[model samples]
Structure formats: structure tokens, C-alpha cells
Target: LVKPIELWTGKQLFSVLLRPHANMRVYVNLTVREKNYSKSGETMCPNDGFVYFRNSELICGQLGKATLGNGNKDGLYSILLRDYNAYAAAACMNKLAKLSARWIGNHGFSIGIDDVQPGGRLNENKRARILEGYGKCDELIQSYNKGMLKLQPGCDAAPTLEAHISSFLNNTRETPAKVCMEELHWRNSPLTMSQCGSKGSPIN
Candidate 1:
């Protein structure tokens, strides 16, 4: 049976958590500080920050910032948030693995772990091209964004921009327009292929 734990808030909880105990006195007090982006008074910009953790036993740190790209325009902030979340998750998994290793022999339990890589940086040239392509299709993009505003989480909606491009290309038999649509589709697709055709020729 577990004893009832006292609940405290704000300064009371802080004092309780921070105060040293008789058996194991606090040896270090580590605080992970993050910059407050609200103080900057900027709009539609990435909030850069750092994270660090230190205890009596170990210290680990990381610094990162958000990125904006055509790849995930819907959830731009998630690009950076995912990295920090992955780092925290990895740290927790490491601690769990160590604990599991100690209990393996006696408890007949083992743990397996997988690798986690950080997100890739957006390529400047590719980004520029994607932006240029979007610039050409401003009306389409605006319509797509408006449609997206109406979509709910589980709505059975078709691929917005891809479908639009496909229809546009089908309707317009112009070779140059078809090439532009193909380039846009290729840029947005998950497959890693060159934006250009054979021998580095421009799509146009």
C-alpha cells in the first residue's frame, strides 16, 4: 500500500522538492533555461532555444531552433518540437535501459533499443525553388489553405496540392506547365529524387 503523498503548489512545492534530505543531501541544483520568445516581440518566426540537464550523476545538453519549409507548411513548429521531444525521449529511454540492465538477471527481463536521428535541415536551393513554384501558384495555394481550414482531423480528404497540380497538368497540355507541375509534385513527395531531369537540365 502506498502512503498518501502531500500535494503542494508553486513556492511550497518548489521548497519541498529543492530542499536537501537527511540521508542524501542535494549536491547540485541544475536548471534547464529556455528563452522566452514572447519577449522578443517577433511574429511568424522560429523560437530558438537550448536545453540542458545535469544531476549528481550525469549532464547532457542540446540547442536547437525551429525551421520553416514547404515540406511541412501545415505544422511548421512541429519540425523543431519533434527534435526536442526526441532528445527528451532518448534520455528517458537511456535511463530505463540502465535500470533494466541491472534487473535483467534477477527479474528475467531485457530491453531492446532503436536508433533515433535528428531531423534534417531544409536545403536552401530546394526551398527557393519550392517557394518560386508556390509563387507561380498563389491562387491554388490560397484556395488550398482555405480548404484546409475547413478540414477536421479524421476527414477523408484527397491530397490537396497534389491533386490540384495533377488536374491542372491534365487540363493544360502545355509541356512547360506539365514540367512545372511535375517538379512541384516531386519536391513535395516523400521520395528523394532530383528535381531536374537527365544531365541536370532545368524542368522548364
Candidate 2:
């Protein structure tokens, strides 16, 4: 009853979770250090990619594992338990479960054919990467067959070729993941989920 506006969006419900009462407040920063984000302060980020909470209100950044995940010693739940008590943290978790369930139920999420389909550029780059990997493996195989392959410190020629081929193929998989991540739109549902560290990864 104290709040002015009628809550309609999932965001409105989230704000209430952040500021349950008028007196309680939290100030937090959980933005990652990367291309556009500065380590000093994220307040100046143009894309609002930085996570900052001021006066118990979420001012910027997407809510992701950095804020909600357990591994972080300074995550939201950890902060709540530290400042208040275990009960406070548990209560907040309960709120999250209910809110997420209801919100997702109301607005369903899915991965369409368009979501997984790669663009022309990505396909071309991926093909090139695969060919490069195969080329390296072929070179190693030819050396081994000719008995000209250099041996590892404790490994024989066959083992050395296998090791080199394995490493190159691993990169063949990893590089395309980075390219795919760059090619997808920020708003794409699967991409959003992966970026948030909720489920799936760039490789998936």
C-alpha cells in the first residue's frame, strides 16, 4: 500500500524484492570487467551492461549468476545473510522462486528454429576454422607416416601426433563458440540465458 504505482511488470515485482521495506537498503556492484566495462566504476557504461544497485534499487545491469549465483562470496544472498541474517536470505530466496515461476509461466520462453540457425558469415567462418583444424591434423599424420615427426619429451611419434591433433580440434570447437556469441543478437532468448549464466553456454 505504501508504494505509489500498481505493479504490472516482472521488474516491478523485482524492485519490491530488493526494497522490501522503506528503511532497508543495499548498494552493490557486480559488473564484469571486459571490453566496454571499466574496473574503476561502471556508472559511466553507455550500454547499462554494468550491475549497480543504489538505495536498494537496481539502477543498471542484468540480473545474472554474478548477482544470484552461489559461488560468489559477495553475491546478493550472501550480502543479505551478512548484513541481516540467514532468515532474511532464505525469505528472499523464497520470493525469487515464486516470482520466477509465476513470471515465466505468464510469459513462456522457447528456442525457435531462428534462434539456433547460423548466419552466412558465421557459417563461412566456422567452415574455415574446421578446415584449418583438419589441415593441421593432416600435416601431423603425414609427418608420422614419413617417420619425420618430432617426438615429445617422453612420448613416441604416434602419441605426439594424437596429442597435437586433439589440441587443434579442441580449438576448432572453442573458436566457433566465440564467433557464434558475437553473431547472435543480445535479445535472443538462448543467448540471453547463456550470457546470464543461467543455463547453456556459448558452445551449446
lDDT of each: 0.35, 0.74
lDDT by residue for model 1 (16-132), tens: 232224454333323222222323423322322222223322122211121112333222123223534544434433554565476565665222231111122323444555665
Best by lDDT: 2
Score candidate 2 by lDDT.
0.74
Q: At residue 106, what lDDT does model 1 achieve? A: 66
Q: TM-score per candidate, in order? A: 0.16, 0.73
lDDT (C-alpha) at residue 176 in model 1: 40
Residues 1-204, candidate 2: write the lDDT tens digits.
Answer: 236966543445556886677776543334332222335557666544466666456655556777777367767788778877887778778989998888789987778999999999889989999889888888889999999999989999878888888888988998888889888997689987877778788789
Which candidate leads the pack in TM-score?
2
Per-residue lDDT of 92 in model 1: 38
lDDT of 1 at 149: 29
Q: How many backbone clashes does candidate 2 have?
A: 0
